[model samples]
Structure formats: structure tokens, C-alpha cells
Target: MTDRDAGTAEASARPGPGTDPDPLLRIEGLRKSYGDEEVLRGVDMALDRQDVEVIIGPSGSGKSTLLRCVNRLTEFRGGDVFLDGESVLAMDENDLRRRVGMVFQDINLFAHLTARENVTLGLRRVLGMDREAADDRAMAHLKRVGLAPQSESYPAELSGGQKQRVGIARALAMDPDLLLFDEPTSALDPELVGEVLGVMSDLADGGMTMLVVTHEMGFARRAATTLTFLDEGRIVERGPPDRLFEAPERDRTAEFLRRLTDLSEDRDR
Candidate 1:
């Protein structure tokens, strides 16, 4: 990070809203692997209805995997996922999916459909909202994210920020109690990153309960109610972002902080 980014980070370190609500999502012994590479090893966390929790770590740290398991997009080898106190591991597939909304990092918008149609797909197909109502709801959410004018435009026609905004609107359209974001802006150019992060900042301002796996430390310090640092499939440290990042307890956590925040370093490498 740059000196200017550090100032921005400090400004964002002010405390956010109140404590998160009771476990909107809870995971226990959540393990997932591909071949012999274990992505999540007995990962555990409690996400509440009013949380703006940010998960950060280096690549392959299971940050994204944890979010996927919460949504059941990636099945776990063991453990249970509870949503609003209901165990997703035991629920029917459709029921589990409806309760959790996800916004992928890639901004997977439909090429053929306009932003309005892409945002309205799940509501129309799953919730049975008619076209007119779907359009109306879609428009409202689009306006909320500053993408109302782009609703009629195709994804290819919009800038990266606009597309990501539509992705946010599409997820919000479900009116989900818990929203999971997987590196939502990792693919964006640096200049475009702020727009997406700005929308997220506004969402945090609006008190949306969300769990985000992101590399945006400035954002975590500024917008998150709590910050979690993970490595090797486990949360190494978690707490208020300022304390955790500024004064981490674990050695690995300190190293992570120095690397991610680009803090001053010791003389030796």
C-alpha cells in the first residue's frame, strides 16, 4: 500500500455498527478437499445478520472456499452449515440455495441478457415474480447501487465497475439475510477497484450483513465490523480490524499484516 492508502485506512478504522445478530450462518468442522489438496480443514465461523465480516489471506488460504461452502456451491467432506439456525447440510438443495445469495469474483453476468434481465432471472424463475414486478424490483436495486441507467445495457457495454455493481444488485435482489462475496473485485484494474469497493462501502453504510473474502485491506479496516485472517484453512486471528491488523498476536498474523498492509519492516529479510 502507498502512504495515501495508509491515511485512508486510518480514516476507515473507526468503529462500524453494533454487534452482529445471532448466527445467520454457522459452520462446524467444515472440511473440503480436491484430490489431496485440502482447501478447508475443520473451518469454523459464526456469521450474523448484521455483520460486515471481512476475510483476508494470501492466495489458496481457503478464504474463497469458506464462502463457497457456506453457499454449498462447494460441498464439504464433513461438518454442518446452519442458516438462521437451520442446518444447510440437512436441508434440501433448493431450500439451502435460496437462503444464501452469492456474488462471484468474476462478475458472471449474462452476455445475451441486459443487466435488468440478468438481475431479474432468479426472481422470475425461482420466486415466480412476473416480468413487470421483477423489472420494478430490479430497477430499485439497480438504483441503490448507482447502476439504474445501465439496467437496459448489456454487460459487455458497461465498465467493470458497472458490471460489478449489477452483480451486487443481482445478489441484493434476492433480499438475502446473508450475502457471500468471493474476491468481488480481484479481477478489476486498480482504477476500477474503487468503484466496486465504494459500492460495498455504501452497503456497509446501509448495514447489510455480509461476509466477504477479499484482498482489500483498506476496505476491511474501513468498512468491516470485524476482520478475520486465515491461513492453511483456519482462522489464525479475528477481531476488530484495527487491533487485529495493528497489533496482531500470532507470529504468522504479524507477518501477514506486514505483507498485506505493507507496514515498515525489520532490517533483515
Candidate 2:
């Protein structure tokens, strides 16, 4: 971590009279490896309430692995992750997932279920809500994503963007303290990317604490309060989006961002 990052983390951890001092999410000395390949190497990060932290990196840089470790979707080799001061590993797996909802690159909605049903599965099973109550809550979240009318449609009947939005509504229905998005729009058609990103932008604007691993520079520039550059299982730079883009403190960060911008421009052409 940079000196600026350390100072920022410290300031964010200090509490006001009515606030809690601990960060909303904290990862310390996190390490993960698959056989001979180490994905994460002693990573540390912290996020306060309502902070949208966007993580950008190359394909094999451990960005997605870090998010998985937080929710225990993938077990780590070392270190700890805390949510609201509670160790995630100590918490029950179901409870950890409830507190930290994840949306993946693939929309994993059940083909047989409607959009509303997909959103309500957790509410009904994990949350133990009755059908009527779950339906009501599910519909509300679907509406928030501008998909209320499609509530009755199956995943097969929806566009890629709509399917991903349903995935978002499903996560939001859990009322997670932090949302993890791993390339949520990567599966969408180019024209469809905006709809999903729009919902994410809205979520960021509405103070949803998010840790997103995405290459969407537009969303990163607009929605992220803090931008992180991870490479080869390490954080190379951490700071505000403007600083990283306009004046990166590290040469590696500047080169990576420039390459990413070039790729995005080529994609746009």
C-alpha cells in the first residue's frame, strides 16, 4: 500500500461519535494458491461504509480471486476477511454469503424460474420468508432494476442484460452489506452493457458498498470512490480515480491503464 493509501485507510477507520470505528470490510494478509500457482499474495484492503471500490487488473491478476475469498466462494490459503468486524471464516458459510452477495460474469439464474422467482429463492429459503412476502420483496427489487414488468419472464426469455439485471436484483434481495461484482457486464452484447452498468451506477450513487472487478472504465471513472490496480497478485496502486487516471504514482499502473484505455477505444471503434 502507498503512504497515501495507508493514510486514507486510517482516516476512514477513525470513527465519529455516532459511527463505528472498524471498516465495513477488511482483508488482511490474504493469500490464495491453486497448487503451484499463487493467485493472491498477502493482500490487505479495507472499505468503509458506502464506499464503492473498483478493482482493475489484467486477466490473471487475482482480482476475482480476492472477491471470492471475501465471500468464501473460494477458500484461501492464509489470512482473514472481516465483514463489519466479524471474521468471515468464523461465520457460517450461508451467513457469510448472505452478508456478501456476489454477481458473476455469467448470469446463473435458473432456466425454469422466472425473474421474480430467481430473486426470491434466497428470500424464501435462506431468509425463511413466505411466498407472498418473498414475492412482494422480489418485485420491489426487480422494479429498482427497471425489470418489474419482466418479473414473470424466465431467463431464457430475457436478454443478456436483463438476465444480469435479474442477477443483480437477486443479490440486492438479500440486502447484503457489501456486493461483489466480477465482470458483471462482460457477458453482455456491446449495446446491452449500458443497461447493466446503469443499474450499477445507480447502486453506487445510492451508497451501496461495492467491491467490483470490472474493466468498465466509464463506470470506474464515474462511480468508484476509490480505484485499485492489482497485478500479479498484488496491489500496484490505490487512490482516487482522477489521480490514477491523470497522474498515477507508479509506472506500472500508468502503463496498464494506458493499455486498458487503448483496448477500450479499439473495442469502441
Candidate 3:
């Protein structure tokens, strides 16, 4: 069975006309610009609870910027981001960050800290938990990512995949309502990619609400509830992954997927 099929059997029970009735995240007329160059232009989308939305696009298509805007890591010049009916822009930055966790492309672990320490830092500092409590929480999440054995190891001692898993563990430790992944596997070696994707697949099965920007089409095909294509700072098309991958409605969307497929084949050869 496909990974999505294995996990999404329960998704049909969610409350919409076809999906969830209430959106957990809603973006309306979102726009972002760097100096004079607009990166995102009038983008609109909504993700239901437990939905895994995968964004794919060519470089410079503002995919990363869109993810950042959702978490307020990058401020947008125009539009609104709402999570669970509350405006994200109006929420306190720390509180908002706590509610929305992010796993970056480059695993941003502290070099001086152990994996456990890295995971516990935010819990102890932001949530103001006692060390013992923080440690317990950290270890639990590390174990979830299959990294409990490496809890005492520093980032330098970990492989790229391990480090990324630690990053994921750190994010999960926050117990955020939503998670954002910005090309989570892009920095890893080809062999290391599967390990991270496997963890992500498990998260999807476990019903984590996630917004991900990735070129990992296999994972997208298997785990995403929706696939969105962005180009020139706008969403050109979006739908279920199977339909988008097999028969994209837009010429641009079809061409983009074809190029990605060709690139994947070339890399394999």
C-alpha cells in the first residue's frame, strides 16, 4: 500500500464536504517582497487539521518564502496568516513560534550542546520547564525519531541524517499545533534521505499537521494530502497528489513535474 493509503484511511472520517470542515491554517492574499522583488504574490490556500501539504516548484518560485511566512520567520509585506481562526500576525512572536514549529533545510543544532540539550533548550527556556521535565520530554521525542541513543552526542558527532532527525526531534518536543519543513532532506546525502523521509512518513501516519517544501516527489506522492505548485510567486495549481502527478491541469504544472521527473531519472542514471 502507498504510505498515504496506509495512513489516510482515517482521513475520510474528517469533517468537511469531502475533507475537514474547519481549516487549521488559512492564508489569504499573502504577499512577500525582498526590496523591490516580490517573492509571493496574492497566494491563497488552506490546510485542514492533520493535512500534509507538500509544495513543489522550481528554484526562485517563492516556495521557501511561503513556508517562512506561515511561521512568521519571514515577514510578509501584505496579507494575513491565520491558524485555528486566530491571526498569526497579532500573536506574540514567542507564543506564535511555540504554536508553529519549524525544521530547517540545514539542521540548526547548537554545536556546543548534545542532542538532548538541543531538544530541551526551547522547552527549558521558552516553556520554563525544569531540567528534569525538559530532559524527559526531549528524550521522548528523540526516541520517536529513533535518536534516543544519540541523545548525549553533539551535532558534530552525528551524521547528516541523524542531525536532521535531531532537528525534527527538537521541533516535536515543542508539541506545536503545526510543523513546517523547508526542504528537510535537501542537505542530506542520497542514502541519508530515506531515513529522514521515513520519519516524516511516520509523522504523517501519526496525524501531524505539516506544511512542507520539498523536491522529494516520492514522499509527496505517498504522504501528501494535497500537492501545490508555485511559480512566479503564485500558486498555479493544487489538488490531490495522484491527480497532480499524473495529470496536472495547467501546462506549466505539467511541464514542471516533467522536468523534475527527468532530473530524478538523470540523477539515478
Against the true structure, whose TM-score is highest? Answer: 2
Output the lDDT of residue 188, model 3: 95
lDDT by candidate, in order shown:
0.80, 0.89, 0.88
Worst 10 residues of 1 by lDDT: 1-10
RMSD in order of candidates: 7.4, 3.3, 6.2
TM-score of 1: 0.88
Q: Using Cα atoms with residue i matched to residue i, what is each candidate's TM-score against the true structure? A: 0.88, 0.93, 0.92
State how far residue 117 of model 3 sits from its true place (Å). Answer: 0.4
Q: What tens digits encode model 1's per-residue C-alpha lDDT throughout 1-269?
A: 23223322432343342223456777766788999998877666676667888988888989988988887888889888888788887787666666677888899998899999998998899788999999999999999999888889999999988898899999889887778889998878777888899999898888788999887888898988778777877666677788887787667878887786553122112
Q: Per-residue alpha-carbon lDDT of model 2 for 60-136, expressed as tens digits?
A: 99999999999999999898998999999889999999988899999798889999999989999999999999999
Which residue ranges in model 1 land beyond 4 Å of their true spot? 1-21, 263-269
Q: Is candidate 1 or candidate 3 better by TM-score?
A: 3
The TM-score of candidate 2 is 0.93
Sorted by TM-score (best first), the order is: 2, 3, 1
User: Among all windows of ten consecutive residues in candidate 3, which has the lowest summed lDDT?
Assistant: 1-10
